[model samples]
Each structure stands twice: as C-alpha cells, then as structure tokens.
Target: MHLIDLRTLQQFVRVAESESISRAAQALHISASPLSRTILNLEARIGFALFDRVGRSLRLNNAGRELLVNARALLRDNERLMLDLQRRAGGTGGTVVLGHMPGALYNGIIPDTARRVQAAHPSIRFQFESALESEQLEELRRGRFDLAVQTQDVSDPALASRVFASERYVLLMPRDHPLATTAEISLNALVEAEWVVTPERAGPSLRSAFTAACRRQGFEPRVACVAGDIVSALALVAHGFGLCVAQESLVRFSGEQILVRALPLLEMQTVYRIVWRVDGLTPAATRFLEALAAPSKAATPRGQRKR
Candidate 1:
C-alpha cells in the first residue's frame, strides 16, 4: 500500500465529516473537481474505495471508516504541531474562525468585541463570518468555525452556549411617525403598522416572542419584508418601508433618520449567547472567549438605559 498522503488524507477527512463532497469543497474554499480528484487519488493509492455511493449520497466503507478514525487523530496531531511552531515563532498568532448572526455584526457588538480581542492579543487573528443562526450551528457542528455568537438556543441540547449579554427589545420607526412621540406604544398599535423582521431561522425565539406578544394584543403583525440583517432592517425603516423590533444594542447604529422607543405592551427581551462546539475549540478560540467572559466595565449606568 502507498504511504498515507497527508493532503489527500485531510481532504478525505473533511468529506467524511461533512458527508457531502460539494459542501466539503465549499468549506475548504476549493472547486469540487479538485477535491474529488484528491479523494480519488487517495483511494486509488490505497487500492480500495473509501466511500460507498448510494443515490446522491455517500457513506464511508469499512476501510474508509477505519481510515477516518485514524485520519482525525493524525489531523489533530498535525494541528498541534503547527500550533506549537507558531507559538515558538511568536505567540498565539492564528486565525480564530468566528460565526455570528447578521444582525449582531451590524449592531457593533461583534466588531467591538473583535477589536478588543485583537488589542488584547495582537497575535490572535480573527475570521468574522456572518450567517443565519441555523447555518452558523451547522458550520460549528461540521468543524468549519471556531465559535458562534447567537441570539437563540439551537435545537441541539448538547451544544454549549454562554450568555454574553441581556438586552431589551424595542420598536423602531420614523422620527415623524405618530407612534414615535409616545414613551411606549402598545403592541396593539404596532399591529396597524407594517413590520420588518429578521429571518425566522436566525431569530426563532425572538420571532416567537414577537408573535406571542401580538397574540396578547389581539392581532397578528403585518409582515412587510424580512430583512436579512439589522442594517437592512434599519435601512428599510429609514425608507419608511416598515417598522422593526430590535434589541437596545441596535441603538448604537441608529442614525438621525430613525427613532427608537420601548413597547409598553411588549416587555420581551433577548439574551445573546456565544456558542461553540465543546470539543472543537482552538487556542485562539479559547483566548477570545476568555476576553468575552471578562466583566464589562462600560455598561450603561444602573438608573439610565439607552433610549
């Protein structure tokens, strides 16, 4: 048998983990043909097919299953060696792949946290990725990312998530809108206005909360357009497309054109959490999380909340 080729071995490992050649190629940032060729070459050298095809899907063969177990161990050792070398050369200078919901990134928390982490640990690199919450969880499960910041709990009960901050939700509208002058508009009043919302998958809990709140108000919301991110939501509001409900942290990005206020009838809030695979955290990921865990000294004063 030909000796193991680490490059081909690595590709095979990714394919096995993702169970889809196309997905593996996308995650590795390579074309499908090249990834397929690598796998074919490795299988040919070993004189046995590594995967069994079933319709449009593939499953590892017995030999492939055995190789995968060893392959993962080898990959881990390889990573350890690289990390050690990097540490010796300088310090913790490696990319920490982070996935966050689109809404969080536009609201400045992700950028601010990333800046602070970089300032504290210059050598630690970051790859900030914006995605839907479901996509984030899937990537985290597939070993594509180091960490994820999300506003809702994923359906998976085993994944570990830590609460980073608790922020209250508020309604946003145009400055001259009738509801803008009220200290707190009732949810029933919101029912008469068109609503802009985040994707359901990204903010399922928030969606549920909003829907339930509307039920309590005796009418369902008239959804206008579902903006994919917070910035888009704010943009829609600025254009008078629809009113939006968002977290108080969103106020950081609000411009003079938009107005924010509390909803007297809707007191629901969202707890933003940092999630990651318990077993897949890298050294940089650990350090960044430690920084996030650090107590915030810049919090708003107790008696005053952001308007």
Candidate 2:
C-alpha cells in the first residue's frame, strides 16, 4: 500500500462531508484546483475510486464510506497533536478568541475580564466579538473560538459552561418621566407604556421570561421600538422616545438623564456564562477563561464615576 498523507486524507473527508470540492475548498481556505489535485492524489494512493461523478455532483462510493470512518479518526489525532504542540511551546502565551453578546459588553464584565487576562498572562493576546447567542454556540462547536460569554441558557449537554453572574432587567425611563420618580415600579403599571426591546434572538431566554411576566399581569409590552441591542435601546430612553428593560450590564452607558429603577413584579434575569468546547482546551485558553470567571479589577469608564 502507498503511504497515505494526513493532509490529503483530511481534504478527502471535507469533500465527502460537504459533497462538493468547492465547499470543501472554501471551508479549508484553499482554492478549488489545489484541493482537487490533493483529492486525486489521495485516490491514487488508495488505488480505488472514492467518488462517482454524476452530471454536476460527486457521490461518495462504497470505498469513500469506509475511508471516511478512518479519516475522521486521523484528523482528530492531528488536532490533538497540534494542541499538544501549542501548549508545549508556550504554557499560556497565545491568542484566545472569545465571543460575547453585546449586553455582556455593557455589563462591564467583558472589558474587566479581558483586562484581568492581560494582567495575568502578559504575553497572551485576546480578541472578543459580539454575536448572537446561537451564533456563538455554533461557532464554539465548529472549534472557531477559545471561549464565549453569552446571556442565554445553553441547554446543550455536550458543551461546558459556568454562570459567572446573573443580571436583572431594570426599568429605564427619562429622568423627568412620571414613572422615574418611584423607587421601584410594578410591571402591571407599565401596561400602556411604550417600550423598547433588544433583538429576540440575542436573549431568547430573557425575552421569554419578560413575556411571561407581562402575560401574568394581563398585558403584553407595547413595543414602541425594537433596537439592535441594549445600547441603542438605552439611547432611545435617553432621548425620551420610550422606556426599556435593560440588563445590569447596560448600567454603564445609560445617560445621566435616564433613570434606572428595579422592576419588582417581573422575574427577568440574564445569566452571563463562560462557555468553551467540551474537548480539552489549550493552556492559554484555559487561563483566559479563569480570568473571565474572576475579574481582577473593577471596570469603570475612563472618565465616568461608579454608579
């Protein structure tokens, strides 16, 4: 038997799974011609046809089905070897990519946590991107991230996550609004109040909680405007457009003219979780998540006073 190269084997697997060389090449970040050549070479080594050419598509042959099983095992081994090599070269000094929801960024934890990671691991670099909860989870499954912080309930048993903190939704109104004077307000009283809300997908769990609270009070929120995220929603409150229910993370950006009061009747809470892949994490990624769990310093804007 001819020697089988791992790279060629991996390309074959991608092509089989995607069922198209174009898609496989795109996923592997290579052009179609080189990928096609690699697959041909792999077939030559195996001495059997892996795929049958149809009019415009390629269908996996019986041999392809058998090879795919071994291909996956080999690819997994390669990944393990790469992870081991990365850790051995540097214990906790590399790039750690993190995904988080926009609300988490406003909660002050994102920056505070990142700052902590920098302090503890000076040589480690960090990148954080705001994404929807589902998108973050999907990317984590694809092995595209080192960590993710989101404000939704992750029910997937295959993934590992820990709740770093819980944030309650506070009623935000214009400073001069009649409802702003109360120390706390009941959700029942805001039945007719025009409200601004975040995107539904960004906080599905929280949205369900808020809707249920409204239903219990015999009313649904009169959504006057739907903002892109918490920041935009709060900005609407600042401009006297309407009231909004924002997480504690948004407390940092609410203007001075906006009043934040606790909602006594509603049981809306957002949990910020630090999630990573179920497989073993690199030393650098592990250290970064540890810092995220325990913020090393208080997070405050450069020119703002603590609330």
Candidate 3:
C-alpha cells in the first residue's frame, strides 16, 4: 500500500484522455514503452486494472472513470497549492490565463479589464484565448485557464461565476437586405429567410436555444451557413450570405455593411460572466478578478448601450 505521486497521476490522466499509450507518449514527449510501463506500475500500485484492452485501443473501465475524476481534482488542488506557496515566498508576477467566448473580445470587455489590471500591477501578465462555451468549461476544469468570460451561467459546484454584463440578442443582416429597412420584424416574419448560425456543441449553446425559440414561433430556422463564432457569422451576414442572431454589443464589429435590429419578440439576453474555480486563483488571477469587479470610470455599462 503506497501513495501514488502527482507525476504518476498526471501520466495516468493523459493516458486515459488519449486512450492510447503511444499517443499519450507522443503528447508527453516520451516514448511509448516507458509510458506503458508507467501505466502498468500505477495499476499494480492501485491493485486494479484501469483500462480495458479492446484490440489495439484501450478504454477506461468503471474504476478508471471514477479515478479519472478524482485525479483531475487532485491535480487541480496541487496546482493551487504550488501557486499559493509561490505567492507566500514573495512571487509578485505570474501569468493569468483567461479562456473566453468571442463576444467578450468583440465587445471589448475582456481587453478593457486586462488593461485596467495591468495598469495597476505591471508585473502581472495576461493571456486571452477565445473558445466555445463547452471548450472553455472543459479547459477551466483541467486547470488550463485561470478565468473565463462566458455567455451563460455555469452550475458546476467546483466553479464560481457572476454576471458582469448583459446584452440583448439582435438580428444582423446586410444593409441592403429587404428586412434591413423594416421598422419592426417578428420571428414569424423570417420564416422564409435563411440564417447563419453557430455550430451545435455540448453545454448551453446559442444555436440550440435559438432554434428552440424559433420553433416556438411556429418555424424552424433555415440555416444557410454554420459559423464557428459570432464574428464569423456577422461577416457572413455582411456579405449577404444570410441573417444571424447575435449579441447586441457585437454590432460594433459589424462595420458599415451590416445592420442590427432588436429582436424584442425573441426575448433572448446574453449574460456575460466572470467565472473561476473556487480555490484555483493564483495571486495574479485574484488581482485581475478584483479589478474586473470594480467599477471603471472609462467603461460604459454593457447592458445600457443603445441598440
């Protein structure tokens, strides 16, 4: 009965995620033979086989699946402990990695917050990565990101989030389109109109919610293109590929070719949140979070912006 080291647990998690010793070794910059031996040793130490051999591939068995969850939590705790120790030893500078939805960048909230934090604490560095909602959540849990700005609230007990801004959904279309000049538009009125939408993925997606809203109004949206993010969707709309539903703040990036109309009938709002793990913030990350929560004199209220 011996305790497994963090390095061994990390190797186990990587093997479980990639499902192949060779692939995990490639990723870990090691050779397959040694990685395989490491996994065998870990299983021997735990007194259980963690994976099921199926042909050339391996799948996590029930015990492996349970261990995977605990392993991730333990790794996250270890990371936080190291960061805390560094801070106590008078480490004043560190990078705060932020994973965010594209809207946060397009609307300038994340950039503004970063500037404010850096101005006061010049030693702190910031890295911003834009990803889908589901990707951001996964990365956060894996300890890859210190913070995230998402469109929807997260319910995971491991993370904490608060709404910092809110914006309504608006219809984006080419300025020369038929509906561009219309004083009012309804979801039913766009029954024949084609749309540009985000691709459907796990977690709460704008596409799924928008599609359901369209169905409640007696029509399914005719998707003309599937864009990865709102910026791409706005570009598609600007080129007359199709109309799109996006956050109102995103209209700032639409240029002159695109017109934005209020989607009052749809009654959708994108709530921007500052999300972080409960005990996972490094010293720099904690400072950035505090700066984000403080009211800024140079910033405009996102929810009160005129449509």
Best by TM-score: 3
Q: Write the per-residue lDDT of candidate 2 for residues 14-66, one digit (tens) a residue.
A: 89988998999999999999999888877777787899988656789999898
Could you arrange the candidates by TM-score from highest to lowest? 3, 2, 1
> TM-score per candidate, in order?
0.63, 0.64, 0.66
Root-mean-square deviation of every model: 15.8, 14.1, 16.3
Model 3 scores a C-alpha lDDT of 0.82
Please give, for residues 179-295, the per-residue lDDT of candidate 3 as tens digits: 877888865568988999998977777898798878777788898999977778888889999888887666667888887788877677767888999988777888877777888
In angstroms, give how far residue 124 of model 2 lies from its true place. 0.8
Model 3 TM-score, all chains together? 0.66
Error of 2 at 168 (Å): 1.6
Return the clash pairs for model 2, or none.
Answer: 106-249, 107-249
**Which has the greatest lDDT?**
3
Give the worst 10-residue stretch by lDDT in candidate 1: 297-306
